[model samples]
Target: MGRPRVTVIDIAQAAGVSKSTVSLVLQGSPLVKGTTRAKVVEAMNELGYVYNRGAANLRQTGSKSGIVGVVVNDLTNGFFAELAVGVDIVVQSAGFVQFLSNTGESIDRQREVVASMREHGISGLLVSPARGTDPSDFAPLVEAGIPVVVVVRSLPGGKLSSVVADNPSGVAGAVRHLVSLGHRRIAFLGGFQDTAVFHERLSGYRSAVTAAGFGFDEALVVPSAPSRAGGADAVARALAVEERPTAAVCFNDAVAFGACDGLRSHRLEPGRDFAVVGFDDVIEARTAVPALTTVSVDPQAMGRRAGQLLLKQIAAGGVSSEAVMTSVRLVVRESCGAPRLAAQA
Candidate 1:
C-alpha cells in the first residue's frame, strides 16, 4: 500500500461515465442526470474515495475570482456580527465569496487589510473605518478600480458613499424621552467630539436639553473611549463635579455599560441611582445585568444596504456622492432611571 491511490477518473471509469459527469455529480450540480449521479455515488462508496474540497472548488469555480472583502473594527461586537449576516446574504445571492477582516480599530491595520485584499483580487469592498481615519486611506481601492462602500460612518469631507444612522434625530428622540420623564440635569458620555456623527448627536443633545427648559451644561458632557473604560471614566469624572447630572446619555452601548460599572463601583446602582442611556442597542444591551436603555441602529439593514450600494457602483462603473441615511429608534429598558423625584411626588 504505497499511497492508497484513488481518483475521480477511477470512479468515473467504474461507474461507466465520463470524468466531467463524475465531477458534476460530486459538486452536486443539477446538470448531471439523476441515474448517472447515483451510479457515480455508488462507485465512490465502493472505492473508499476522499474528495479534496479545496481542489474541487478551484476546478469548478475556475479560479479564486468571486471574492468580496468586508473590513470591520471588531468581530466580537454583536453589531458587526449582525452586519456580517446581512453582507453574507447579498454576497451569497450574487454567487460571490466573502472575506472578513477585523482591524481592531487600528488605522495601520486597516491599511494592511486593504492592501492584502487588493493583492487577493477582491471584486469589491465594504468598510467601517477606524476612528479618525482619513478618506485618503481608502485611496488604494479606488486607484485599483475596486468598488467600495463605507458603512455606519462617513469619511470627512463627504468623500465616500455611506449608509449611516440619523444620529441627530436618534439623539433628539432619546433626549426627548428623558425630558418627558422629568430629567433636567442630563449628561453625555463617550464618542469622539470631532467626528461628524458625534457632532450631530451632541448638537441634538444640546438642542433637546435647551428645548426641554434645561440649561445645556458643558461641564456634564464627557468625551471618552466608546469602550467600557471610557464609560466608567466618564461616569467617575461626571460624579466628581459639584453638580452631578441626574441622568447620562452615552455614545453607544459599550460606553453605557462602562458608565453603569463605574456607578456601581461608587456603590450606586445605575438605574436607581441615576438614569443612564446608550446608543446602538447592541445584543448585550437587553441581556446586561440591568437591561440597557439604548438607541437601536439597524446594523444588519445598514450592512445589506451598503453591500447593495457598493455592488450597484461596481456594476454602473462607479457613482458620485450618493448618501443613504437609515433611521434609529430608542429602546427603553431597565437603565435610564425613573421619572424625577419631583414628578413622582
Candidate 2:
C-alpha cells in the first residue's frame, strides 16, 4: 500500500471548496464566509489533515522562523517585567516564539544582542533604549529589511516607529495634584537635565508648576539615579538643606522607595512630615511601607499593542514612522498627603 498523503488540497476537495478558501479558513481571515468556514473545518477534520510551513506562512504572513526578539533596558525592573508579559501574550498567539533580551541599559550590550538576534534569524526587534544610546546602532537592521519598534523611549531624529506612555501628561497630572494641595515648594528628584524621557517629564512638571502660579526652583530639583539606592542618596542630601521641600516628586517608584526610606531614617514619615510621589506605579508602590502615590503605566498593554503594530507592519510589507502612546493615570496611596494649605483651602 502506498503511503497516505493528506494535504490541504485533499481537504479542499473533500470540502468542495477552492484551496485558497481552505487557506483563508486556516488563517482565520474574517473575509472567509461563516458557512464556508464551518464546512472547510468539518472537511479538514474528516480528512485527518496535516499542517505544513505553507499553512503557517498563510497564518503569519511573515518569513520569520516563528520567533521575534524583545529587548528592554532593564529586566530587573518590575515595570519592564510586566511589559514583557504583554509582549509574550501577542507573540504566542501569533504562533511565534519570543526571545527576551535585557541590555541592562548598556548601549554596547544592546548592539551585541541585536547582532546575536540576526545571527539566529530574528528579523523583528522591540527595544526600550538605554540612556545616551545612538539610534544609528540599529541602522544595519533597518537597511536589511528588518522591522524595529521602539518602546518607552523614542530616539531623537531617528525615523523609527515607537510606542510610549504620555510622560508629560502623567507628570503634569502629578504636579498639578500636588499644587492643588497648596505645595508651592515641591521638588523633582531622580532626573538629569538631558534625555528625552527626562525632559518630557520635566517639561510637564514645569508647565504644571507655572500654570499653578509657582516659579520653577532649580534649587529644589535634585538629579539622582532612578533606582532605590540612587533615590536614597539624593533624598538624604536634599533633606539636609536649610529649606527642604514639603513634597518631593520622584522620577519613578524605585527612586520613590529610596526617598521614602531616606525620610524614615531621618525620623520623618513620608506622608506625614512630607508628601512623596513616584512615577511608573511599579507593583512595589502598592505595598511600600507607606504605599507610594504614583503614575501607573500599563506595560503589558503597551507591549501587546507594540507587538500587534509590528506584526501589522510586517503584514503590510512595510510601514512608515508611526507612534503610539499608552495612557497613564495617578494612583493615590499613603505616601502622598495634601499640603496643609490644600487641606485648609
Candidate 3:
C-alpha cells in the first residue's frame, strides 16, 4: 500500500553509477570526480532520495552526530542571551546543530535537559550551570563519554573544561577605581553569598579594600537577590546603616539600575550623591541615564570561545579538563562620577 523508499542503490542505478559512487557523493568525498558527484546528486534529487545521516553515522566508526547541546541557567538575562548567541555562531559554522535549553536556575531542569541531550546522542555539551549544580550531576554524561564544556558559572573541583570571565580581577578593578575616586565608604551590593561568583567577587572586594589601606568592614557587604528589585532593596538597607556607604559596586547591571532607582526615590542623584558600579556591561548599561560604569565581560566573545572549546573536545573524543578564565575590564561611565571629576580637572 506504501511506495518503496528510495535507496542509494536506486540513485546509483538511475545515474548509471555504482552504489559506492553514491555513498562517496553523500560523504562529500573529493575522491569522486566533480562530474560524477554532480551526476549522483542529480540522480538523488530526481529519484526523491533522502540521505539518513543518523543511519550513516551508526555505520561509521567514531563519526560525530553533528549535534552540540548548550544549556544556560537564565535565558532572560541579556548576558546569557548574548552568550548563547556567541555559542550559536561558532557551532553553526562548524556544521553542527545546537540543542539550547534555558534552565531558569533550576537544578532539576538542568539535569532533565542534559539527560535528554544525551539520549539524543549529542557529540558535546556547553553548559552555564544552574545554581547548586553538583559534580555528581555530570557523572552520567562523563560515563557516557560525551564531552562537556562549562561556560560562565563553573563547578569547582570538577574534571570538566570551563570558560569563565576573571571574576576576582574584575571586582578588584571596580573596587580600586571606586577607592581612587576618594570614596572612603563603599558598599558591595546584591548577589547571594552561596555562589562561587559571589565568593570570588567578595574576596576581590575585601582584598582590594585592604590593599587600598581601607578597613575591611563586613557590614558594608549587602547580600540580596541579583535582580533589579534586589538591588533596590539592598541599597535601601545600606542607607539605613549608621554610616551609609557613599558608593556601591553592584552585582550586575540590573542591580545597578535598581540601586539608581532606589537613590532617586530617596531624592539622591545616583552619580552625584551616590556613585554606583555594576558588572556585565550589558547593552542597556551604555544608554541608561548617567550611563552605568561596569565590568566588561564580552558575553558573545565568551560564548564563541566556549563553542570552540566544545568542538575541540568533540573532535578529541575526550574532555581536556582545562579551565580558561577569560579576562574582564572596567569601562568607566557617568554613573561612577568619573566623567565629572575629569571635567573638573
Candidate 4:
C-alpha cells in the first residue's frame, strides 16, 4: 500500500494542539493566537500536508476551500438560471466562487456532479435535487461535515436546511383571482406528480378550487413534465374533456408558454380565447406576446437567501436545520385575461 495520507489531526498531534485548534488554524480563524497558528502551520509544512484533502478537508468543522458547489436538476429552466445568478451574486460578494452543475433531472448525473464537486474541495453545497433522489443521497456530504442547503426543493426528513417558496399560498391566490374573474371551470395544468413542489402547488389549487364554492374536479388536474412541451400536451388533453375548462393555473412560466403555443395551434388566442396563469415569473413572462400572468416567487432572492444561509452555517461550524419559506405574490398580466390594474402584483 502507498504511504498513509497526512491529515489535520496528524498536524494537530505534531503541533501538540487539539484537533479543534488545528481546524481553527486551517480556517484562518482570528481566534487562534499567532503563536499557535504559526506552530500548526510549521507542523503542516514540515509534514508536507497541504490539505491533500479528501473527505478529510471536510473533517475539519470550519475549513473552507473558498468554493461552493451549486447543483440544479434542470438548468434549462430559466427560473433555475435566475436562481443560480442570485446565488452567485451573494457568494461572489462573500469572496467565494460558485461551481455550478446541471443534472438535467438525471439522478446519475446528479451523483456524478456532486462527486466531482466534492473532489474539488467544495466548502459547502447548494442543491435543487432531481426527482427520485432520496434524502439519503445527501447523507455522505452531511457525514463529511459539509454544509448543505437545498434550494427550490425541500428534502423532507433530510436533516438539511432548505429555502423554498410558499407554493400553497401563491397558487391559492392565483386560483382565487381566476375564480373572481368569473371562471367557472379552471384547470390546474402541467407538472410531474412525484415531486413535493408539484404536490404543494396542487394542494393550493385544490384548496382554492373547493374554497371558492366550486367542487374540485379531478379531471381538471393534469400532470405533465413541467416543461413547455409538457404544458402544450397537457392543454390538448384538457381541451379534450367532455366539459372543457375556461381557464388554467399552470405549474410554471415554461408550461404557460407551452399552453399558449398549444392554444394557438388550435386557432385559439390565449388572452382572448382562454385565461392562463403560471408560477415562477421568469424573464420571458413579461416579454411574451400577451405577457404571462404568474406567481412571482423571486427565484433570485431565494438563491441569495440559500447562499447566505449556507455561509452562516459554514461560519457557525455546524449543520443548520432551519427551513426558510419565502413568500410569493401574483403578478397580473394579459395571459390571465386580467385588466391592467393601477399596479401589477
Candidate 5:
C-alpha cells in the first residue's frame, strides 16, 4: 500500500514541538521564536508535509476558499493553454490559487472534476464545457451558489454566464475575404455539427454564399472531427465529390494544418493549388508551413475577460447569467493563397 499523507502531527513529532506551537508556526505568528520556526520548517521539509491551504481556509472561517477552478475541454490545444494562462494572470494577482483540470471533452470527466473542486472549497469555476454538455450538468454547482463562467463553447439556453468568440462574424469575414480573392466555390470544411459553434460558423458561410449571389450548396459544407486528422479526412471527402472547391475554410488551426497535409498527400499544394482558412489564430499558425490564414478571436483576451467576470460575481455574491461576446478579425496570410507580404493583423 502507498504511504499515508504526511500531517501536522508528524511535523510536530519530528521537530520535538507541541501541536499548538506547530500550528502557530504554520500561521506565521510572530510570537513563535525564530529557532522553533526553523525547526518546524526543517521537519516539514523532511516529512514532505504539504499544506491544504484551501481546506484550512474553509475550516478557519467557514467562508469562500481563496481558490478558483479552471476546467478545460482540451488542455493539449495551445488555444486553451494560453487561455488558462490569462485566467491565471488575473486569479493569481487577486491572491487566489488556481486548480486546473483537463476533461479531454468528456462530460463525465468534467462533472467529476467540477464536483471535486467544490468539495475542496473553490470560490468560483471557469469552464470550457465539453461538446453536447447539457445545461443541467452544472445544476449542482449553480444550486450551491458557485459562480461559473463558461468560456469557448457555451450551453444554449443555459442559465450560466458565458464568454465566447463571435463565431458567426469571424467566419463571415473569412468567407468574404475568400470571395474577394475570386474563390467562387469556397467550401466550409471540418467540425462536427453537434456544437453551437459549428452551427454559428456554418450559418455565416451559408449567408455569405447566398450573399455572393450563389445558391447555398449544402454539399459544400463538410463535417468532421475538430482536429487535424479530421481536417485531412474532410478534405479527402470533399475532393472525392464530382464538383471540387478551389478554396476552403476550416473549423480551427488544427484542421487547417491537417487539410494542408492532406492536400500535400494528393500532390496539391496549399496556398498554391488550393486555398485554406482556419479559425483561432493559435501560436503555431504563424510558424506553420505556408502560415495559416485564420480568424483572430484572441483566446487569451477572452479568458482574461472571463476571469474578471467570474471574480466580479464572486465579490457580489450573485450570478448574473450575463453572456459576453468578444469580437474577432480575419488575419489574411499564406494558407489562403494570399501574398506572404500580408503581415499578421
Candidate 6:
C-alpha cells in the first residue's frame, strides 16, 4: 500500500505547534514569529510535505493567490522572450510566481491558455495578445474583476491597462534619419497591414516622407511576414520596382537582417550599396555583421513596467484600464551607413 498522505496536522505535530500556527506559516503571514515559521518549514521539509497552493487558494475567499499569468504571442521571438523575462524579474521580486504561456500567434491557443490560467486562480495577467484578438475576448476576465495588463499590442475598445511603445514616433525618427543620410528612395518593408503596430509605424513613415518634401509612393511599401524571410521577400519586391529604393526601414530587426541577406544575394553590400534600418534594436542587432541601425523599444523595460502596472491593479482589486505609451529612440549604427558617413566627416 502507498504511504499515508502527509497533512498540515502531521507537520504541526512534528513541529510541536498548533494547526493554526502551521496555517499562518503556509500563508506567509508576518504574524507568525520567524523562529516558529522556520520550525514549521523545517518540519514540513523533513516530512517531504508539498503545499497544495491551489487547494489553499480555494479555501480562502477574497485572498490573493500570489500568482500572475503571462501570455505572449510568440515566445520564440527574442523580443517577446526578453519581455517575459522582465516581467518575471519584477513579479518574482514581489513574492509572486508567474504562469507563462506561449500562444504562437494563435487566438484559439491564447484563449485556451488564458482559461487555464484563470482555473489556476492567478491574481492578475500580462498579455501580449495574438493577432485578431478582439476586445470582447477579454470580457470574461474583466467581468470576473481580474486585472489584465496588455503589452506590445493594443486591443481596440478594451477597458484594460496596456503598455505599448511609440511606434509612430519611432518609425518617423527612422525615416528622418535615413532621409538625412541622402536616401531619397526609401521603402517600408515587412509586417502585415492588419496589425495596429504595422499601421502605427506605416503612418509615421508616411508623415515623415511627406514632411521631407517627398511624394508618398505606394509602390515602395511592401507587406510581408515580420520575420527574416519576410523581410528578404519584401526587399526583393522593393528592388523590382521601376524606381528601386536605395534604403529601407524594416518592420523589425528580423526583417532588417533578411533585407541585408536579400541585398547580398543581389551582389549588393548593405551599408555600402544599400542602407537598411530596423525597429526593436534586438540583442542580435548590435552583434550582427553590419551592426543594424534601428529604433530601440527596450522590451525588458516594457515588461517590467507592465508587471508593475498589473501588481498595482491587483492591489487595488480592480482594473485601471490605463494606456501607457512608452517612448522609443533611434540607435544609429553601421547598417544604415551612419558610421561610414561619420568617417567621411
TM-score of candidate 5 on Cα atoms, chains taken together? 0.81
lDDT of 4 by residue, 297-326 (tens): 998999999999999988887776889999
lDDT of 6 by residue, 12-96 (tens): 9999999999989988899999999999999998996756565466676656587899999878678888888899999999999
Q: Write down the worst ten-residue block by lDDT for model 1.
A: 336-345
lDDT of 2 by residue, 228-330 (tens): 8888887887876678788888888888888998888999989888889999987778888788899988778888999998777766665457888889999
Q: What is the Cα-based lDDT of residue 206 in candidate 5?
A: 88
Q: Residue 170 error for model 4, in Å?
A: 0.5
What TM-score goes with each of the models? Answer: 0.77, 0.78, 0.81, 0.82, 0.81, 0.82
RMSD of each: 12.6, 14.1, 11.7, 9.8, 9.5, 11.0
Q: Which prediction has more favorable TM-score, 5 or 6?
A: 6
Off by over 4 Å in 2: 1-63, 338-345
Q: Once superposed on the true structure, which residue ranges of model 4 sit more than 4 Å away at CA?
A: 1-64, 340-345
Candidate 1 residue lDDT tens string, 222-254: 998778888999999999889888888898888
Candidates ranked by TM-score:
6, 4, 5, 3, 2, 1
lDDT of 2: 0.81
What is the full ranking by lDDT, best candidate first? 6, 4, 5, 3, 1, 2
Scored against the true structure, residue 254 in model 6 reaches a CA lDDT of 85
Model 1 root mean square deviation, Cα atoms: 12.6
Cα misplacement distance, residue 155 of candidate 6 (Å): 1.2
lDDT of model 5, residue 105? 82
Candidate 2 clash pair list? none
Cα error, candidate 2, residue 243 (Å): 1.7
Supply the TM-score for candidate 6.
0.82
Q: After aligning candidate 6 to the native by TM-score, how far in Å is the CA of 159 from where it should be? A: 1.7
Question: Local distance difference test, per candidate?
Answer: 0.81, 0.81, 0.87, 0.89, 0.87, 0.89
